[model samples]
Target: MKKNFTLIFTLLLCLFYIGGNAQTQFWSDTFEDAGAPSSGSRTASIDFSCGGPPFTSYFTRTLPTGIALQNGSYSLFQGSKIWAAEDIDKGPTCTNASISANQQVTWSGINIAGKTGLSFKGLLAASQLGGWQGLNFGAAEDFLIVEYRIDGGAWTKALAFYSNVPAASPASSNQLYLDTDGDLIGDGAGLTYAFTEYSANITGTGTTLDLRFNCFANASAAQELAVDNFRLFEAPPVVAPTVTTTAATGVGAVKATLGGNVTADGGASVTERGIVWATTANPTTANTKVTNGTGTGSFSAVISSLPAATLVHFRAYAINSSGTSYGSDLTFTTNAALSATTSQSNVFCNGGSNGTATVTASGGVTSYSYSWAPSGGTSATATGLTSGSYTVTITDSESTQITRNFTITQPTAISTATGSQTNVSCNGGTNGSASVSPSGGTPGYTYSWSPS
Candidate 1:
């Protein structure tokens, strides 16, 4: 289970933000109890207008119901209440409300002492209801000006807002914000008068942070503004990404397929991921590696041109801003594509079973094993073979094998084709004729023909 950090900001409403990673939330405010100054929350106001109304307060916290916007009245963006500069009751003689001149309202001293990567956001709603059709949006400072500062340092301007008005302004440009959806009723009612969210990233750290909204007006026209639901966030700490090395597949003498999985990114983007291999165990990126791609998820690559009949070690890896991380080492062994050579001796003489078939295995693991066919031989050499066909199956230690087929042959013995002898036609005669023809065996018949 994951730990949760959230605060309920309102009585009837619950407001909070969930971090993308395991990030921490420093501070947040929904202004749930915003009311008259008598409420005494962490808020202050200042009035700087000519007879700034007949009121002692510069701002009033109330339910957001913007009536001046041409589109329609405003509603609370969140919770039940908001801090606004608009006046609820305008006196008979007062030409402007409490937010006439350089009036300001501040929500101060929100703690963020040791926070880094500070991000903040809030909701704002307003309209240029009365005059000055300006779209410059606080460019020259007219309506609500949102500013923030750290540890009471120099205030940094963030965003400004305006309201509904005529399309053209007689003096400076106004009506920077209006109901642009065309559903509202006003001269320049195109932009929405609804409350919208605005966010900004803040750098530097301090014990406390302050948010201030300054409302500037000519003390002649009526304007409305409200602020609500401000939140701050901090990014999660970064570490090396988590990755797992998968087992090698399709392993061969010189090639293999291997890959890995990026289970977690450790709060940072995985910029690089790949595989590394070497003859030794625990290989690293400094060794032979194939970079697959960027980001998370499963990826694979082929490692080729490896030595034959060797044991290789490989690992999967991933890279992020934090650093590099590797998976467990995986091992695979390659056999040398078994092959063999053979020498055979035919039957020494006809009708003799002394033929020999011998095989020399190579291209495989050392101490090779051999099997001969015809149910008589199991070693490298097969002996006592007649004139017949035979086969030998040579296997390596790694279960790789090769079969060699050979024939045990025999030679014909000497024989006579045709022969005749002149029978002693003239026995013991001085002119006795003898003739004979012989074939077979090795040519050149010898003259040891019996009765000499």
Candidate 2:
């Protein structure tokens, strides 16, 4: 009984191992080991005639120096070798000529079980020798077709290439040349190559896959297509970033400083991160925002031109290739501005000291203090002043003060003078005359004597 139990436990472990391997399945190939065809020789044509489905074909490898001008001189996607359809055909003679029959290369036995998608990358080109003026009459009839099959199903078109077409022509349109170069034969203007990336979504429960690349060419046109760095993998799921909005500080009547932190990037690089604020609740990017550059981590922003004593809502936001994410809402109120007013009374004339100044404070914080320029008490009102400019300063609990100036004018005074007259008879005696005058008042004055 113990032997049977041990055997069952060993089988369970094997099952767990297999399941883990399937979840992490991945495959890739650069075709660098596919030996190059003999000089001036091409592989046999492939027509999917292998009795069943999923037919494979031979691949031709070349070094960067071999096709540098036609294709870029860069090494293969992964190695120094690039794979493509054989360059020369094995028919009548071994020369640099076009193939008499169509040729194809294929990749098979791709296990995509439990996979989400696949991608392929390569470079392709079609050209003829002697420039664009040395091709046969029917050279425009050549083309290359790329197809794929799943679970031995029917082939589906993936990509296609054609020779004898202008470099600027659309892929779906066929370009025709009329031998305008006076060469009497068809030709092409050098070589045109482009790198391409293709992707497809994997559906169903398929476990195996196949891909084919077929090149059709005329008897006089030298056509070629190269593929390199072909890879297959499961697409990762998209996730949004995680961020947090901290409390605000440095609050003022018109500005405040806010802070935020990006805790996680959500499996992707953070492209945009910043803080957003609004006068209402639940702020978003539609409101006032400040960009704090890219990447994750902590950031701070100062919001300016805000209204005084206003309630503001703010939050942190981060964006990645997947989507934008926002942090929790934060609230803060701006400090109120100081508002104070003053009233004054002028002093009386003739050196009278009855001037007064009163200061009234509002808004801002309470617990105010008053100060006078000359010399006075801390009360809001200041009195006993002559005639001149007087200043009073009112300070709030926040240490913010407002100073105002007041003036008191001098008043007019009156004066009179008299001289005793000697009692003298009606005779013309100088000592018997009396004199009186008025001064120390307005220039224009009038007086009347009683008993005149």
Q: How large an RMSD does model 1 have?
A: 10.2
- Cα lDDT tens digits, model 2, 35-69, are 43211122324321111111111235555444423
Query: CA lDDT of each candidate?
Result: 0.64, 0.57
**Residue-by-residue lDDT tens digits, candidate 1, 311-357:** 99999999999999999999999767667788999886668888999
Model 1 residue 183 CA deviation in Å:
29
Task: Provide TM-scores for the models.
Answer: 0.55, 0.38
Candidate 2 ranges beyond 4 A from true positions: 1-27, 33-100, 108-119, 125-140, 145-160, 165-210, 217-226, 231-237, 241-250, 253-255, 259-315, 319-452
Best by lDDT: 1
